[model samples]
Target: MMDANVSDQRLRHQHQGLWLVAGIAGVLLLAAASIAIGAEDLSPGQAWDAVTAFDPADNRHLLVRHLRIPRALAALLVGAALGAAGVVMQALTRNPLADPGLLGVNAGAAAGIAIAIAFFGQAEAGAYVWFGLGGAALSGLAVYLLGGVRQGMNPVRVVLAGSALTVMFLALTHMVTINSEAEVFDQFRHWTVGSLEGRGFAALGAVALPIGAGLLIVAGLARRLDAVALGDDLARSLGSHPGRTWALAAFAVILLAGAATAAAGPITFLGLTAPHAARAIVGTAHRRLLPGAMLLSAGTMIVADMAGRMVARPGEVGVGIMIALIGGPFFIALVRGRRLGHS
Candidate 1:
């Protein structure tokens, strides 16, 4: 029995290692493809040369360094953040359909941007990041407080509170937009769709610390999350502190989702679909699922961004719009196939 148990553990470890290797390889391949394929069309050799040398005097090198590199990094980070956050939320809530957006994080960020634009007249990318992060943190805290009633933070209550908060904040944002001038709407409209265009390394710099810290926290809490998944009472028996676990998970989600939302506007469905897909592929081990989900999310976003660039000819469909277009139907199908409430 001891030998068999050891063998089983070894097998699981091997399986997880395989998934990690595949995920990292996939991310590298997607990153290379993202840099090589774009509207301006640089050959693989040229792109490699441009990236390696990165000479400002050469237009190709300059564009690759200043534009494509930053945009690709942003997409990769945003995707990873969304993916990790999704996995954490699902584990925390034990709800298969839970997503950061479902908890009003995205809407809160949007409302923050709208308020910033309406009052402060600061539309800069750097400024938007701060506003978005503040909004996400505040909204997430509100949802947690409201959800943590009665016995504790019930998943259903959290979802309900998030849905209600999202609606309220969205309504407020709409009202503000409606009352404002066309110019303001025009500015907000672009942000609402979400894109990585015209953004610099500065945007990435602002989010690096928070995202790094969040991913580290998520990594440390992986075993705790796994324990929590065995049901609250069982997890408690196993020595897991459910409240502390939930609090850490919540903080990670806010850090990740907030940073992503601040960098790009509220991207949809990546969070929901990535973890679900990862689970389907690799089973429910949080250690495997978390990293797998992150890679898959990054790959999905890079592919979506590439498709968006190609589909519209000279014009591009921002990543946010593309995700909504793809994720909406996927989400509907998922909801129909599974009784999410019961699950």
Candidate 2:
């Protein structure tokens, strides 16, 4: 019986390993498609040569090398960040429906961007990203305090707090930008809609550190998240600090979701959906669930980005709009179901 049980465990691990590899390959394929299928769509050969050969003499090659590749990479990073953050949020809250956005991070980040563009006269993403990150971190901190996660987590209270904060931040953002110049609002407009249209490698590099740190934090906190999911009392008995975990997870979410929002404007629904979907596939193990969610979310982002490029033909739609359209129905269905009531 012991031998049989060990064999079964090994078999499950092997199967999961295979699934992880397949998931990675799938994301890579989607990313390749994203690079090749933008507004100035490239042939697969051209795409390959753009990366490998890099004929600067060819305008198309320059477009692919400088423009498409950076945008695709940015999408991948943003998606992975949102996905991992979502898993951490849901696990920390014991709510499968819990999204990082529910912490009001998006609103805070948007508000920051608006202020930067309007009051500070910052136009570039790199310039405003710090303001965005600051806002997102503060928002997450406020939510953590208001939700009383350290005292005791109540999903209803946390969601309510997040909702209230979101409204407040959004209203303030509008007020801040109401009298700004046309150009300022124009920049804010494009950002609020969440486009990958013009993001260059610099923006991608700027966000990589925070997102990478956030991922590392989440990856390290996996077992702690699991213990917290079993409830604070049990987690304490198991030698885990539930309160500390809550704080760390919130910070991690701020880092991940904030940097993601910094990179791409608040792309909704990806953060909410990825973890829930990953849970269905990977069970409740935080270790497995976190990475699984990241990969799936990365693939989703690439596909959404590619679809955004195609949906308007010569013109392009923003990735944010595409994600909302795709994830909106799923969100509705999840809400209609019993998941929200309990978690």
Model 2 residue 71 distance off true place after TM-score fit, in angstroms? 0.8
**Alpha-carbon deviation at 95 in model 1, angstroms:** 1.1
TM-score of 1: 0.91
lDDT of 2 by residue, 220-249 (tens): 999998899888889999999877887788
Cα RMSD of all models vs. native, in order, equals: 2.5, 2.4
What are the TM-scores, per candidate, against the unseen true structure? 0.91, 0.92
lDDT of 1: 0.84
lDDT of 2 at 161: 90
Estimate, for each residue in 71-137, the C-alpha lDDT of model 1 and write its tens digit: 8888899999999999998888787777888668898888888888887886777777788888888
**CA lDDT of 76 in candidate 2?**
87
Cα shift from native, residue 69, model 2 (Å):
1.1
